[model samples]
Target: MFDFVRRHNRILQFILLLLIVPSFVVFGIQGYNKYSEGRNHVARVDGQDISQSDWDAAHRNQVERMRAQMPGVDVKMFDTPEIRQRVLEDLVRERVVFAAARDLHLSPTEERLDRLFKTDPQFAGLRNPDGSVRKELLAAQGMNSALFAQRLSQDLAMRQVLSAIGLSAFAPESVARAAVDAFYQRREIRVQRFDAREQLGRVQVGDADLQAYYDDPRNAARFQAPESVTMEYLVLDLPAVERGISVPEDDLRKYYGENASRYEQPQERRASHILVKAEAGGPADARARAKARAEALLAEVKKNPAGFADLARKNSDDPGSAAKGGDLDWFSRGAMVKSFEEAVFALKKGEISGVVESDFGYHVIQLTDVRGGERRGFESVRAEIEAEVRKSLAQKRFAETAEQFTNLVEQEDSLKPVAERLHLTLRRVEGFTRGFQPKEAKAEDAAVLASPKLAELVFQSETLAGKHNSQATEIGASQMVAVHVSAHQPARKQALADVREAVKAAVTQARAAQAARTEGEARLAQWKARAPDAASLPAAVTLSRARSQDLPKALVDAVLKAPAEKLPAWVGVDLGGDGYAVVMIEKVLPADVADTGPIDKVRQQYAAMWAGAESEAYLAALRKRYKVEITGKAKAAEEPAGAASK
Candidate 1:
């Protein structure tokens, strides 16, 4: 075959090309086109497009990290339009900063990286006793040591772009002091309040007034009832699955025996060591010097055994334990460097070990104490074993059962059938309007009801029209809910006759507030024309932003904003529904400057605010420089009524 191919090399090459080119044309080109068609670009930074798939993957990673950090929190809270938008913004910001850093040639140095790992508190968990990066910790975050180092270097470079602006921010002391004084300035004032409720009996409303108030266009939404539905929902979750599972006695005992080591408490050793620090990868001469130091400490300890702790406290190089006589409190087998652990475990209590070398350095170890290393009896851990076995079985079965549940929900018209099949209770919620939150719902039920997706599905036109079951929706990890609308009522305006009492009450309150304001204004004009008797005014009280004296915010604002160039200036304040107030300004007092602590705090706060503003402005400039653009619409997540704006 070789001889034949060699003789016809050109012919063979032509044949190969004929076969390869056609395959590439048929699959490679078409497949590439299909893939490109599906990749919808949601954003772009520095002319590099970020597709929808990329945004989705980033959002998923972010949600998973949050879920890991707070397992008990509702997943729906993290998987929202607003949170997704934030993720996209973060992605764009990261790209923009990276571009800026790259253009500015802001790469971090090796020494800087080393110092950051050793000194930064945030990286403490990711460092070893030898002051080296922990590969295992990096692995847990799905990165190798090299990749982690690269990412850290990139992050440091990016931070320099913003840190230059943020860290350099300074607030002039004089300006800060003036602003703080104005913010907390005190005013002594006399207030005469006209309570609206006092005028309610005097202001009368008839049927005509009530009807007119109810028919007003401005008050339409106030009287209109929201569309609501009576829904029956079936929840399939890990807990529900676990509840239905039963672990046999024999299985429980088998599991306990198979995993007996898990029930055993590993032995712990309390040891003290005087360490002579030396990096494993350092010069050989340095390692030898460290060994000599350890040997010298060992000799001193052996000569005066009772004075070992005093010697350790004086000579130990380990900062964490040096002050405490070099005591490394009780730790398990895998907690220390292998060589150090071996030396400590070999020594008897109160015995000292010869100089032992490890990655960190040389150590003179003294075994202090030993404890634990006991296996719990079977009977004592039987209940725990059974619970574990049941949970494991339930978790394994959840995916399969979830598939069946989803199918059953789609096939059936009601949730009852699926609920019975899955051994789940068919729960009903009456008058469940869109965005309705049950005040006293169980945690699980509240999580299900809180899902915006489930609410959207429930109120769909088809689901409402046919009163059928909605498709199963995954509201959380291993949690699915299928809802059925048993009955629904579309939104409609309430009749005037039906809401007569409510309208009457509203009309009376409005008229009463107006009457109170009118009377208060008249009193203010009279008082301003001529100085009223001090006895006629209410008791004088000091008011400031810090101390409102339990007065309404509007009233306090009016008093403080009144011109104080002339003493005893009068100001009229409209308190709306509360009523009105006539304020007589007696005096203005500046904020106390004697306390340096508060003044320093105000200065620091002003600096931080300035830094934040500067950082935001810098980031905006970087975004413009990079030509970052968000192509997709990203709406803010819906907030509940009375929720503070983001």
Candidate 2:
């Protein structure tokens, strides 16, 4: 039986076993690295040793992920020393985070593990009704329930630890409110551009200067074109197999019979409450005393005909609705705390409950109403049931039809004959770019373009349209199409006329920049003559001033690039689109400004920020203390195939 299962699909069997094994480490930075002799130690966070084997394996995984994103990326692209170092840094950080999480005692719950294993889309159709892990899929993913649970638990624990650390640091309300208001108030600006057409006509470019400017490599960069291509193609329509399959009444009835419980919803109730909180400037045993007083008040209210509202207003500690006589608008079960919910459920309509203690405080609840939780009558939900039944039938039939189509395409090597036999029309399209949108293309065509594989195939120069190729790929549910390329037009550089305005703008900007540079240098020389030293420099055509808070972005850019001692030196900057400016720094300030704002708010934001940095430093110190050693040689030996793939 084991051999038979393995023979069914080795890849899936291995995955199932792997899932049973443990959660694989997922760290950024991966590549292929071969040790000429023995494993080398990479880095030590505190004393934790990073092994070369683990680093190499993790790096290989990163390369695989990148290839999956852009399949044509060369393996050599990730072979640089910088790339390897980056991968090492990422691995070190991950180890630190993992070690810290373990120290903090964070863990994933059984419920969360179950959610992770079952809620995956791959297992959507595999689960049993009671929510137990599916046996077949568990075997397929190479994961038993226990192994999956363990791995899931660890991953979740790590996430919880990170979340706790991240949420510990929060921007102040002043910052949050400012960010929120900015987010809300942000508008797409549509600037009415001031045309330079009249002024540009008055300007003349000397032929010699124009030719010299055009010859400059920097000026020529703007005219460079991206490589493009067009391709001919044939698409097989395997998805249409579902359309060809028939849904019988017996199949629908069988599905409905087996899954009857899914069509039902459990019953629930609604109630309201008046709460007298325990600790509102009360005695030492405030909660107990409040509950006792609430009990007495509950009895009094029940006895009084119209005094329930008056009593609630006088005694309820809930400030939100105390003015409305402690009225808690309607709420369903699970909406209230456990103790309060239990009390509310136990009561009948118009019945008053005894004092109940909940996390909030002492509560006196009055049952308001109850509603049916059972499935609605069949007549009211007939249409819905029919749709559900139809979907089930469709899925079952589609599976069989898909298998047939797969066999047909694999054996026949053509979709034309199949389309003819099925009495379906074959469509042809004119020459189109891989990402092009044609007027004749439908929504489904857009979906095809959206697929990475289909898009790749469309752009692949090797894929010829007219000859037999792979069958039509399924882009979605309930839709199938087979297409043949009627013509092909290889991508070409666009005409200069198509980008004339852009070229003109680029040329104008170049001229403006040259003018700004010439003018700035002349002004700087005049200022330098008067000052003799940078310290003596004063307000002049070349001098511009900026404060810490109001530093002009152009000025900041120039200062950042200049020598530290030359900070206040005037520098010229191009602000794009033919704009330019000369700027200088007036002052420099430390990041921490004690009197800038409210001390309390500043303290709150800064403490959290500093704490995270402290935590990171602390973890690094701990790794150094523990002397964690990663066996690089052992890691490489474990996944040689992955390295080879990279």
Candidate 1: segments with Cα more than 4 A from true spot = 1-58, 231-409, 414-430, 435-457, 472-483, 593-596, 620-631, 636-646
| lDDT by residue for model 2 (1-646), tens | 3564445443343343233221334421121122212445665543545566667776786676566456567675676667777777666656666666677777766776678657775444445777776566566555566655666566566566556655676666666445333222211111111223323554455545554555566765555443232333333343343345455666656655566676666546655557777764556587777788888888887888267777777878788767887667766667777888788778887788887887677887776667655765555555565666556566666656555555554455456665555544455444444455556566765565445455444433323343444455564454433334334444344455565666555666556655555555565566445434534443432111222334346544454454434334455555544444444444433322333345466556566766688667666675565564443322222221112211
> Model 1: per-residue lDDT, tens digit, 1-646?
4554455444323322222221221112123234324456898877766677767766776765566556686776786778888888887777677678889999899899889879977665557799997665444334576655666676677778899998998888898888778877889899999999999989988888887888889998878877787878888998899999998888888888888899998999999989899998999999999899889889989999888789888998888998999899999999988899899989899999999998888899999999998999989998888788888999999999999998999999888888888899999998877677889899878878877767777777667765568888787789988888878777779888778888888899999999999999999999899979887888999888888899999998888887899988999999998789899998899875543247678889888988999999989998998899899656655543212210
Identify the leading candidate in terms of TM-score.
Answer: 1
Error of 2 at 553 (Å): 7.9
Pairs of residues at least 3 apart in sequence or in different chains that clash in candidate 1: none
Please state the error at residue 313 of candidate 1 in Å: 41
Off by over 4 Å in 2: 1-58, 61-201, 205-328, 337-368, 372-374, 379-383, 386-447, 450-452, 470-486, 494-505, 515-646
The superposed Cα distance between candidate 1 and the true structure at residue 257, in angstroms, equals 15
Clash count for candidate 2 is 24
